[model samples]
Target: MNKRAIIIGAGVAGPILALQLKKIGFESEIFESRSEGNTREGAFLGFTPNGLNVLKEFIDLDMLQEDCTPGSIKFFNSKGKQIAKLDTAYQKQRYGVETFQLKRANLNKYARIAATNAGIKIWYDKKFVRYHEANEQVTAYFADGTTASADIMIGCDGMFSEVRNQLFKEVSAIQYTKLISTGGYAKIPELSKPLDSIRMTFGKRGFFAYSVSNNGEVWWFNNYFREQQPKPHEIEKTLKTEIQDHLASVHKNDDPLFSKIIKNSHEIIAYPIYDVPKLLHWYKGRVCLIGDAAHGISPHIGQGASLALEDTVVIAELLKSHKDYETAFRIFQSERQARVEKVIKSARKVGNTKTKTNPIAAWFRDRFIGFFIGKQIQQLDWIYGWTYSNKNSH
Candidate 1:
């Protein structure tokens, strides 16, 4: 029971996995490529019941919910006409936890704190270069010329994972979905009333979404079609003014509030979205992939973070019950691949709805979207209601 493991990337998956592994007699060391205090890239994300249940095992739900807004979503057409709504309160009644939205930085901070407090070591600035698996052990090589070996190695390094690349050299590259998302927080006093729902719009030129937290901060984002994939450096070098201008123009015709939110936002970040192709295998020898490293989904479904959290629980549970690491890794992939692929496919379909559409199609969508949303909610019972303990029950 004194096995040691190496987890790459201290993102949502790594820290939670470390904590879960610790509970089952496994010592884990997490290695993150970025240096400490560098978790300021992404905007906010949603936490569904499935993901929250996993976090609740080690972290306080109230602490995670603090400063977050209710995740109930309201949809609208270009003219600002309400189209549909998701009753998250009903979801809470069904799943035992309500959905909420919070900044990515806050979740990262809390997760790392929980892992470290539980005595798990996290090594920052240790970019994983490659790993060598032999004879029941895996040795992870870092870009900093340091090496760490463990009985098992897990990749939580995310979409462009070096671990996944090294694991399957012949696999196809991650696919760019040709969509650019930009968002930031803004202080809009007049619009700061807690709406208890994220307002989403199918704008004339793009898709926009916004919500107000109890703390009076307006959290918002927009998605637009980008035919060519943006370069990493290009996204990094893009100025806040440029993003603000672009968003202001895109959402100009939809709602005045959308433009106001953009004008007031001091900081804006933009990045092109990418999707990971299906893998034939998620594990090899003593090393394995989990979370985004294994399957990356679009943000349209709001299941990306939640799915990653679910992976941590499933893998940890399997590793504890299985006799060998190889068996556990195989079962983990088998148990997860189909469900994750279903989610990835559904997310892609949802993302497609956000893209540019003809006026006729948009008109039909505005009217019928409510019915479709209601059906989707009924279909999502399996996702929100799922739990690691009931894996076999399903």
Candidate 2:
């Protein structure tokens, strides 16, 4: 019998997995809670080489590059001192690809369209309420009273995953980082340098980053923990205060980049950061968890979407080798768990680096890490340099 897969969530991983399955002559369907292609009001998403390569296999890299802007990332200390500048060309040489920044909504729309064109069916407003897994097949029950069955089920439903709840017991749970992210777009008459470079400031108040989007909009964000109790209108009030404080701390009072950007800024949106510590198992029988559903990495690593795409490719490659569902799942979990655990640890460390309240500690941490992070960054070579072949080779 021909094998089929049921994918949860229509986010980055779901559509990509469905597309990869199509490449391997498997049929798959995606179920998403959102009724349309619009995303949940996300800002810019940075696609590292690891993610770009996987996407290039199915889509046109040149086209995506043209659609988005190619940029470099610059790191800074709390006092707006340039710590280091990442070389995009060197990264391309090392990983065979370069990073690009694109709007999260547009990227999702593109993936959704690509999946639809590849003949993958998507059902909206069909939230998976539960699942019944048998030795033969896995059936999903949606809150809309609809039922569907497939040969295999993969959950990419994100941190608060229903699939994880239905299939696997709570081996771990999402932990709040006490940090909040607030971001919005700003219209610029003209940027000094096309705003192609990312500027990040690290401080005791927290970390703030501002970069130009492909559409000539300035995308800026500030991350900080609440000093006191949060009221109902706390996030909104905090956003404005934080922005004002961030600009003042950076001595950007007269800088056109800061003044014009904030002058044209829109309403800010905020959300708390959450992630699972790690999962011992990502699968049970015919159902498996992928992306944030299985191991939700912090945005600190800036690898969440990239990791999700990587999971899709790796799991698909593993499944091709094993004829038995259980064996395939075991292989997938064993291979992914260790790597994900390392990433989770590294991400938390990076996040903590920005939250040190002591000025001396913050300075020491930033400078010490910045001067010696080349080795640490090189450790990521294995991840970004990975690719899949038809022969099931690593």
Candidate 3:
């Protein structure tokens, strides 16, 4: 009999992991804490070439494109002058895919649909509270006091995973990067023309980004610096006008586009940026972790969705190649640790650049930033150049 797996969380990572496992002859069920599957409250996400290629395993690109937009990228300074742009033609020609992006909710919808089409069942409202290791199976307890057992359990829960907390006695895996990310869907009424790509700006105080679709719809995000971590209420508070006014101040000297985009947003979503340092362990016995549950790199580099998809493909591949779960789990950690940590490191460096508030530091960054952005596209080759298979994930 094939070993059954229990996947926790029905977010992007959980559904993709389920489909990948099915491709490898393993069966699994996804348990999500939310009452239902899809919603439109979250922000947008970008999947680089490497990530999109892996997702192509079970999803059709055309089907996904219907929900989200895929395009190239251009970077600029606060003055609306172009700094450096990704050679999209070169990226597509070389990597077999370009940057594809959509809202987080839409991406989850697509992944869940794909998983369902492949015959994977998703249980809603099954909040994973904790787990217990048994002689031959692991039992997962949900918030409703219900339980389920499987030969293996994988946590795709997220950065603040309860599963991860249970695995380790103390909780030091997630570290705050001292940044608050905010974004929303809007209509850039003043935008003279539609854009088929992402436009990023590095200002003296914050990092601002926006993408305008061909039909005049806009999806934009901002990363602002906050010296200390916020309280739970602050993170959950809804203060659109207040946040927009603050953004107006931060982007006061930036292009009028920045302030206009902020004012245009119908609603704003906000969250903290955090990263998971390399863990001492990824799995033990019949339980393992994947996706953000294992690594939560900051989104500065736009690889969060892609890296999670890569994790699904690799874990499924490892299971197919190994005879037992023990070997599979061990190899999974060894193979994934190095690549993901590199992404985290790169994101940290770029993210810190957005937090520069000193006059001298801002001057130094703005003057020399072109050099860094020039090097950025070259470094992306290493990131978007990756290709994986169930036969050999590397």
Candidate 4:
């Protein structure tokens, strides 16, 4: 009998991991807590070269790029003065592929289509509860009262993963970083005619980012530093009027561009930012964790989805030698810990730059951001330049 793996979550990492495993001689079933209807409608995501390369190993990116624009990023201060630009389309000459922008729903949609075409089975609305590992095999329990037996269990369920809660007893839990994020889409072709590039601003009040597409579709988001996490009910209350008025007041002392973006928003969403702390263990017995469940990084660096893709890539490669499953799990953590931890730390540092409230500190930040970070984009080559191959792994 072929080795069967049980995967939790059907989001970004889950479906892609399912495809990767299926290609590598492993049969797997994915269990998602959400029914299909709710998973769609995420705002937009930057799919960098590193993540795109990993996805290319399983499916054609051209099929997905038709809906996206080149992923060039230009940094600026609150005054709208350009600092530096990372022209990802041109950088493809150096990194083999360029970064691109796409709605998260489009990527998820394509991943599901690919997984379905590959004969993978996904059980929707099956929320994971706990797992039992005995006799060297693992069985997973779900909210729907169904069970699955597999040789390996991986948690790809995002940051607030129940799988991590059940398996990783050594760690307390994923912690909220007290940063509230809000984003929306707009149609402002006149103001955002330059669709080839993404514009990011480090403001005195907070951090703001916006991008325009050739067709007048604009994607934008803002990050605010909060001292306390908002309750579930409060989060729901940050809808159109509240978000618009709050954003208007926050930028009252600064540029009006950010206010314009907010005023033009079709819809807005607000949520607390969370991150996974350093883990003493990523796996125990026959079950392990992957993606956001294992190491949820803050979105400051915009590499969350890319890092998840990288995780699934390495896991699939290591799993090729099935008899040494324990060793695969062990080595997977060893290989990934340093990289993911560094990213998490770097994201925090990036967050700090956005939260500067003092006038003197804000002035210093805007004045020297170019001096310090202009060349820093090149330092990220280690991330965008990575490629997966058995020869490279050794």
Candidate 2: clashing residue pairs, number: 0
Q: Order the candidate numbers by lDDT, best to worst.
A: 1, 4, 3, 2
Candidate 2 has a TM-score of 0.87
- Best by TM-score, which number? 1
At residue 328, candidate 3 shows an lDDT of 92
Model 2 scores worst on lDDT over the 10 consecutive residues at 250-259
In the range 256-306, model 1's lDDT, one tens digit per residue, is 988999898866767678988888999989888998889988888789889
| Candidate 4 stretches greater than 4 Å from native | 170-172, 192-194, 239-241, 389-394
Instruction: Give the residue spans of candidate 3 off by over 4 A.
Output: 67-71, 239-241, 357-371, 389-394
> How close to the true structure is residue 43 of candidate 3, measured as C-alpha lDDT?
76
lDDT of 2 by residue, 1-394 (tens): 5689999999879999998888766799999988884565565667888888888777676656554545576777756677876546677888788777776776677788889988889999998888887768889999889999999999999888988877655565667777765566776667524466777766435556778655666777666575443444865466666655565554353344554565567645566677775666788878899998998987776788888898899888777777787787787777777877777888888787766657877767567766565675677676667665534343
Where does candidate 2 clash, by residue pair?
none
Candidate 4's TM-score reads 0.92
Residue range with the least summed lDDT across 10 consecutive positions in model 4: 234-243
Relative to the unseen true structure, what is the C-alpha lDDT of residue 250 in candidate 1, on a scale of 0 to 100? 77
Per-candidate local distance difference test: 0.86, 0.74, 0.79, 0.79
Give candidate 2's error at residue 15 in angstroms: 1.1
**Better lDDT candidate (2, 3):** 3
RMSD of 3: 2.4
Q: lDDT, candidate 3, residue 143?
A: 91
